[model samples]
Each structure stands twice: as structure tokens, then as C-alpha cells.
Target chain A: MTAIAGKQPNYKVAPPKSGMTIKQQALINSIIVNAIVILLVLLWTIPTFGLLVSSFRPRDLITSSGWWTAFVTAFQSGAWTLDNYRSVLFADAMGSAFLNSMLVTIPSTVIPITIAAFAAYAIAWLEFPGRKAFFLVLVGLMVVPLQMSLQPLFSLYQATGLNGTFLGIWLAHTGFGLPLATYLLFGYISSLPVDLIEAARVDGATPMLTFTRLVLPLSTPAIAAFAIFQFLWVWNDLLVALVFLGTRADVAVLTTRLSELVASRGQAWHVLTAGAFVTMIMPLVVFFSLQRFFVRGLMAGSVKG
Target chain B: MRSVQLNGGPVMALFEKTWFRVLVSLVMIMALSYGFMVSTEFMKNQDAPRAMLAIVAILVGVLGIWALYLTVDNLVSTFPIRIRDFVRPFVFIAPAAIILGVFIIYPTIRTTWLSFFISRRGTGVVPGSFGLQNYVSLFTDPATFRALINNALWLVFVPSFSVSIGLIIAILVDRIRWEKFAKSLIFLPMAISFVGAGVIWRFIYFRATFGAQIGLLNAIVELFGGSPQGWLRIEPWNNFFLIVIMVWLQTGYAMVILSSAVKGVPGELLEAARIDGAGEVRIFFQVIIPFIMGTIVTVTTTITILVLKVFDIVFVMTSGNFNTNVIANVMYQQMFVQGNFGRGSAAAVILFIAVIPVMVHNVRSLKSRRF
Candidate 1:
């Protein structure tokens, strides 16, 4: 586990202490484990710091005072206001629903990592015929339930007019993100080193030139960790963009335009706290700039399913 | 004849004619199915110039499937090499097996054959409405038996309080020292959006009837003097305040996968179970919970298949409305707000027979890793 989450454990092998000796019982057990991990990291960061301080206070001091009283009226003057992020980014359009959540998360994360990296390099280095029954039917279609294919793929995308387009929610998020992007790029292109795909097939090349010049550049860190896990599962998808992109406003997206501004500005807590921080500023800037390839592609997809 | 007269005579004898390379691979699969029907009709038009023709129809539908797999690998290298190694791994597994057989295996066998029949108002499916009357009105529907006991109390309290508060914040942030800045602030609500953590826990379960209580859980229940309540309309504890917004958006994906299985236990087996005297809570339940019990059943069956398709925290907090519904928000209120396609394909075939025992324990642990 990345060597115990990157070292620091050897507390001088302290166990046999008595009468508060071993460095004062390891400084009272590191101040009772850093005060219960800073009180469970302040109860998991005070409900996202009380909706990012009621999305910068204003609207009548956020429904008459309480985002912990704007840290005790910190320099009062109508305490904080980017006019609730300039009226949820230009008067509630949430800046074209943040360009329709980057037009439905950059081609639903580059057409499901280019059709699951050509079917995970043909089920990790081709052989052909039913290839282990198409990799155990892509690990039994990774636990099927997208409510059993959303009502017959919404009546086959309303009979091919592909219900609310953008190439029908980018071919329905490349068939619900191709069975966990061909089972996490076939667990990193079937653990590569088969003598570099038999030295690009004994030099003659061609399995489409050894999968586009030897397994697509040694599977770019499992295709950039399943492209940040299919761009934060198609940018925090709200039921596959509300059943294949619908709630219209120029093809809604930032979680279906922040769940229609929490059902038509639910008590306009400053336009649902600056429209839920403009649909959480691109999955919190791709979860804090690729948090180690989103926790190593979420522990290589929950330690292989 | 002599390498077809040194490879250029009548274009290498019409590319070594096997009926002229199967009529040029059936005219390049009918011109790549008429360039994917004119870029899916210029990505469903919307007054043209659409963001430069939908970025040139998403770069010709992802480089038109890599130019139809490099023209079917140069028409399977003009075949005849034992049918070019038996049609080249179905040309790199036919566009991910025809888009996972037309979007998830033929719409999960056409929503389990439209959950056996009868569909009225939302039109279609009627003619001699088949049998098992929509799984007997989805087990005699009292609002789908309160969405099957709020999807079995969100499958037993959202995977046991998101794997026991993500295995106690992955063993108290693996004994701090800013353990990666407190495990990235409890995995920052797994990067928000369950409708932006249901509008940040609907502003900490906001209640406010008259004055003060601007919901930080009704201003700490009106600073301990009690009063304010409606934490998502109380009935049956508003289904555990909508299963504490799916255990606060799945306890940071069970604390970053049980903090990498509690830093994969082994620190000389926790200093040989603290030199045999074993204390630190009995070396965390006998040596780091039996050495991260296979990453705590792989983060409790990957949060029990994401709390059995929970559905955007009860469709953005209580759209299930007091006495919260679940089986994927009653199969999206019986298929798109009461259109009732045979009780929403029998509530999506009871969430595909409750995800066939976690898809046969993830295909028997991917056939015991014999990938």
C-alpha cells in the first residue's frame, strides 16, 4: 500500500514503556493521535465549510445570519459577496451550465477512453475467438444496474432520434463507460511485459501496428488512470445527465444544471450557494489536480471490483 | 506471377483478389455506415454552427473509430493469411463489442423484456399484456413497498456507515503528521456532486422555521436549547436523513479505499502485536483487523455496489419526499416520473435481481484473477 502510505511509522519501536517513560509515553501517544485526527478532520470539514460559507454570504446575510455568523462578522460591510458568484455565474445560467459541463464531460471522457482502449488492447493482446468469452463478458458487465439499462435505453433513445443528443450522451457514456473501461484497461494492459508483445510480434508489427505502435505508448498510465475515472464519471453525472442529457437549457449538464438549481432555486440560498459552487468547479478541479491519478484510479477500480 | 509482376501490375492483381478483397471490405463497411450517418446527423443539429459543428462532431466520432480501425487493419491485410489470423481479433473486438451490445447488452435484454408487459399511459407495450403483471405490481405497490423498505434501509445503513466511518478515517488518518493533509479532508466528499453533495447537505440539513436556525443542523439544534427539527421531515428519521446524504457522499469512498487497506497493515505486524502485550485496541482488532480482511471485503463490496444504485442521494435529497423511496428512486419514479412502463420495468427488474449477488461476487473475483 505504497509502503504504508509513504513511510513515517517507526516510532523508535516503542512498546515496553513504564511509568510514563518512553519519551513521555510517546508524547501521550502523539497527543491522543492528533486529537482524534483533528476531531475527525473537523467532522469531515464542517459540511464543506458550511457550503463554502453559504457561498459567500450576502443574500440578506444568507437567509438572516448563520454561516457561523460569517466568522463573527469579519469586517461587517454587508459581509462577503461576489453577488453570490455574480448571480450564479451571470444570472443563474450558471455560465451556460459551465459550458454544458464541458459539453458533457469532454466527449464523455474521450469516447470512453477511445472505446476502452480498443477493447483493452483486444482483451489484453489479442488471440481472437471469444477471448475468454469476451473477458468473462467484461467482468459480467461490471454489475449491470444502471437501472438495468435505463428503461430500454430510454426506448432505444426514443427510436434512434437518440433522445436528447450530443451523439446520444456520447453513445450513452460509451456504453456506460465500457465495463469499467474494459476492466481497468484490462488491469493495465494485461500486466504488459510479455516480452513487449513478443517484440512487436517478432518485428512484423501489425495487430494494428502492435496496437498503434506497441500498446498505445505502453498504456499511458492505464490511459491516465481511466482518464481520471471517466472524467469523474462523466462530471458527477446526475443519473447519466438526467437520463441521457435532457433538462434542456442548452442541454443542461453540471449535474443537470445543479439539479435544476436544486429544483428552481430552492429557497435561493444565494442561488443554491452560487449554484452549488458552479457545479463544484470541475469536479473540484479534477479532484485537486489529479489526486495521484485519482487515488490510482480509485485503487485500480476497487482493487479489481 | 513473379510477385504479381513486382507488386504493381493491375494494382498488385487487385489486392490479391479474394473476390477483390471482399469487394473492398464491403465498400469500407458501407462507407463507415455513411460516416456514422453523417456524424449522427451533425450531432442532432440544434441550429448548425453548434460549437463548431459539435467540435466537428466530436472529431468525427472519435476519429471515426480510429478510421474504422485503420480501415479494418488494411482490410485484414488482404485476408488469406489463414483468414488473416481469423479476422484479426474481430478487428480489435468490434467497437467494444458493438457498444457493449447496443448500450449495455441490448438494454439488459430489453429491460428484462420490458419487465414482462403491460404499459398504458406512457404508451406502447400493451397488446395482450404479458404475464406476472409487472412482477405483481412490484410486490403489491405501496409506493413500491416504500421503495422496498427504503432499499432495505439503503442496504443496511449505506454499507455499514460507509465502512465504519471509512475504517475510522482510515485508522485515524494513519496516525497523523498531516497524513496527506488529513487524507485530503476526508477525501473531499468524494469530489462533490451527488448533486453537489445535495447542495452541500442541503446547507447542513437546513430547517429554519422562523428566525435564527440557519441550518448547521438547525444551528446545532438551536444551540442545545432544542426546538428546530425537520431534518428532511422526520418520519422514520427521514430515512436516516437520506442515509446521511449517502454516508456523506460515501465516506470519501470508504476513506480512500480503507486508507489503502490501513496502509497495508504490516509494520512488522504492528511491532509484533506491540511486543505480544497487544494493546492499541488489541492491535486494532487483533493485528489490524485480520490484516485488512481483503481490503475489508474490497471496501465492503465497493460500497455494496454503490449502495445498490442509490440514485443521486434520493434524487437530490427527499425528492422521494419524507419516507424516502430508493430502489433507484422507485426506478426513477416508475420510469421517468410515472410514465409507468410496466411499473418501470418492474422497478428495473428489482434492480436487476438486486445486482445478481454483486454480479456473482464480481465474476467470482474475476475468475480468481486468472485474467
Candidate 2:
């Protein structure tokens, strides 16, 4: 949301009118920029790449030699194996944890979008009583530290019989997610031309009809953006799942499970690597596939408000 | 589903009246409650077959809400336009309000209340009698003091390093040939969970047997003829090692945002600076930096809040061991692990108080932007 509200940066390369000396200077500048960019890129990527390479290497080699050494004819030396993935997937029940992550993420993502779409539309277009006050509160709630809510919410869950259930975690995620979702969607929906909604109303379309038919379709970009953000967030979350759902194997999401593996199996780098990879795969897919929307969502959050 | 028309014959017209529609709304609400019950029960006992049932139950619950909406909409449609105008927005905002109030707002108040009272294990707060003993102990305890100091260190270091590196990379990468590809690499760490990043960097800092250091940093140390050291076991430095993971994760976010801001700087300004015989370094600091200062502040503020609540990395990496405890981790340990709900609530209240000024500033900025 912040990114979207900012002016789109001009990406055109400026051509210089210069003599031979200036041309050489430009070349030197380009060379320096390229060197620094390459160095930083490698610096950022090598750690994760090393972890990925270690995920494939045998446990003995992972603990015995640095992962970089495996890059030299790693496969040719027969240092690679599928055993880590197999053991993590089967023996450690990470496969079920992956499914559990999906189960927690899908409804958590969907319910918020559904609820926020309506709320955002109303805040954006309708002249309801206390509209500004309500919008202000929502915006303010965006920065509330979620740690404050954990203990009481956990206790409340016990009273309501929602504890340790998927429904409880889903509700927690939705509540935590709503402020920003509503805020981002409100930005997009509010910016939609008044003429369109007025035109729909001038016809015989009811408010619900207008929202379902016009607002929902028109707000897909915002919806897709929030969807991707929420999906990655819910899928990758460790804290909420740990607190609300507890660490029971059947209920543990991928992150909680992987963290538990780290705690209980601290020396098992092979399994940890593979398990980490397993948990990472979904968010990575969502991120890469929906990268444009994801970045848009980030920019939209700050720039709009 | 849309084919069902309420505007039909006399009998249908009678059913479409406000009273009949009100009955439908009530029934739909009951249906939604029932669906929730079934779903919760299904999820609570998830086994092989029941897992599938749980998934189906979720779908049923969602559909039930949708059906409730349709029913409520038909009821609202039966109202006069003026009444509908006011009622419809309330209808739309009600579900979100209920959930947020129950989950976030109510808990916030409850936590504040719990902070004043004492907690008993296995049960919740004792409710009426209130005291400041929890807060008193929270501030005086050495562990908490260390945690506060560590949080201050994180607040200072993480944002500063992240913003500076991000600014440097963003400035450097813009003139390169593979700008998008390189920026993507820098931004890649933001995609990994903090837990995952912790594991990745743990490998980077791994220490093996003497003379056979396996971690990249330790290996590099050994290659320089220095002996290997346990990176995470060392106090103060271990905190720095953990901070490195956060810097790695956040720099990409800062870079991507700042890169766009840098690109937004007008070309003429840079050209004018260059014509005045300014070097690139001076152009960057004096001309370019000043232009994008707002975005730089925005990025810094964003990372500042993140550093404040940074629990996942510390939780996963050191579990606050070796003097790495921060406020959020300490709060969590007190609340859940130690079952000191009163103290945990106090810690949480402290965190909430810390966040209020930032959020208020954010809201004011947003309001100013609107006009």
C-alpha cells in the first residue's frame, strides 16, 4: 500500500552528451556499480544457497565439511542424497505439518478478504455514522503489538471452547489481519471513481448487489495483494500457531513443527535443513508467483496511510 | 444461486416482506453458529479420516456465512432506501468488528486488567484485586533489565544497518546491467521466514570440532590460521550474530522500497549536481539522499517496529540463551513457558505502551495525507 501510493519511479536510462573523457568516466562509474551490486547480491544469496546445498548433502558431510566444499563436484563425489528429505518428510511427520500449514492458511486468508472487502467498501464509499472514527480506529489498531493479546486471547479461547482448534487460530489470524486488510482495501476502493458506484445505484442495484458485482470484481488487485500477503504470513507464522494451536503434532503447522525439530533434534542438521526447505516451499511459491501483488501490498500499507 | 428471485408471485411477495426476511436472517445466523460448532468439533479430533472432514467442515462454515449474507441482504433490500443506506454499511462492517473486538480489542483490555492481578497456574487471572507488584518485579528483575537493554541494542543497530546497507545497495544497483535480477537476489531473504533465516544463518555460524570448523564464518576464520570459536555461545557477540540474521532478512525490504524512492528522484537534479562538478559520492549524499529522505524515514520506521517485536529469530536461534533475550521473547517466556501470566501480561502491557506513540504518529501522518 505504501509502495502503491508513492509515485512510480522512472526507470528510463538517461543518455549523456559527452566527449571521450566523460565517456570513459561513465564507463568507470558503471564498472564500480556493477562490482558492488554483484558483491552484495552474492553476499545476500550465498547463505540461503549454502543451506539449500546442505539440505541435499549427507549428514556426515554437513557436519564434517563446510557446505561450500560440496560445490566442487558435489554430485560426482556422491555426497548428495535424498535421505534427509525422506527422513524429514516421513520419519518426522513434516508432510502432515505441511498440510496442516495449508489447512490453517487457506481459511485464514479467505475469511479476512471476504470480511474486509465489505468493510473496506463501506468505509470507502458509504456515508455511515462514525465512518471516520471507525476508520481511524482501524488504522490505529494496525500497530498494536500482538504480543499483548496472546495470553488473554489464549485464556478466552479456553472459555469459549475454541482452544487448540483450527477455528481458534483462524479467528486469531483473521482478527490480527483485519486492520491492514481493511486499510489496504479501503485505499483501493475509496480511490475508485464515485461515478461508478453512483451509476450502479442510479440503476436498481442494491448495495449488496453493487458490492458483489462491481466492488468485488473491481477490487481484485487489492484482494489478490492482500491474499498473497495473508497466505505467506499465515503459512510462515510460528508464534500464533505455537500459542493458539499448541505443539500437538496433529495440529502443529510447518513452522511450529520445524521449530520443535530444531529444539528436540538440535544436532540433526540434515533433517533441519530438509524440514526448513519443506516449510519454505509454499511461501516461496506464493511469493514468486504473486510477486507483483506482494510488493504492491507492501507499498500500499505505508504509502496510503 | 443467483437465479432465485424474491420478486415473484403474491406468495413470493408475501415471503419477501421485511418480517419474513427477518426470520430468514435469524435462521441464517443460527445456521452460521451451527456450522462453526460442527467445524470446531471436527478439527478438535483430527485423525486420518477426520482431517478430511475438518477441511470439508471449513468449507461448510464459509458457505454458511455467505448464505447468511445473502439472506441478510434480502432482508436489508426490503427496507426503504434511506434505512437501507444506513443499515447496509453496518451489515458489512459488523462481522469484522465482532471478530476484531473479540480477538484484538477485548484481549487488549483483558491483558491490561490481567497485568494488575496475580495469575494462578492452570487457571486464568484472579480478577478483582489489583496491584503493581507484577510491574515492580518486571522492572527490577535482572533478566528483564538485560532484555530491555538487548531490545535497545536491537532497536539501535538493526534499523540503522538495514537502512544504510539498503541505501547503498539501492544506489549501487540502479546503474548496473542486471538491476532487476540483482535486486531480486538482495530481496530474496525477505521471502524466507525469520525461523528459516535463523536456521540458514545458524549453518553459516556453525562450529565443528577443533581444527575442523564446518561453518562458513568459522571456516573463514580457520583459513586465516585463526582457531574456530562457538559463535552463538559467546555473549554480546552472539547477539550480534543473531542481529546479522535480521539485517539479512530486512535489508532486502529496505532496498526494494528505497530503490524505488531513489529512482523517483528527478534526473535534472542529479544532472545539475553533476554539472556543478560534484562527485558521485557528494551527489549521493547531498543531492540524492536529501530527495529521498521521507522514504528513508518510512523504511527506518517500518524496520524499527519490526525490530521491537522481533521474537521469531531470537526464539528459534538462541531461545534467549547467552543473554540474547529481548522484550517480546521475555514476555512470551513469562506468559506461556513459565506460566507467570501476571508478569507476562505486565510485559505485554509495557510493549503495548511502547507501540502507542508510533501508531499515533502513523495515524496522524495518514490523516494529514488524506486531506
Number of the top-ranking candidate, with DockQ as the measure:
2
| Every model's DockQ | 0.27, 0.46
Interface RMSD, one decimal, each candidate: 16.3, 4.4
For residues B161-280, write the lDDT of model 2, one tens digit per residue: 999999999888877778888887788777788888878887788777643576889889988999888899998888888988899988988999999999999887876676567778
Which model scores highest in TM-score?
2
Q: Model 2: clashing residue pairs?
A: A1-A299, A1-A300, A1-A301, A2-A299, A2-A300, A2-A301, A2-A303, A3-A299
Model 1 vs. true fold: TM: 0.37
Q: Candidate 2 on A63-86: residue-level lDDT in tens?
A: 777788887866586689999999
Candidate with best lDDT: 2
Which 10 consecutive positions of candidate 2 chain B have the poorest summed lDDT? B1-10
Query: DockQ score of candidate 1?
Result: 0.27
The true-versus-predicted C-alpha distance at residue B329 of model 2, in Å, is 0.7
In model 2, which runs have C-alpha deviations exceeding 4 angstroms? A1-20, A75-77, A301-305, B1-29, B47-54, B80-82, B122-129, B368-371
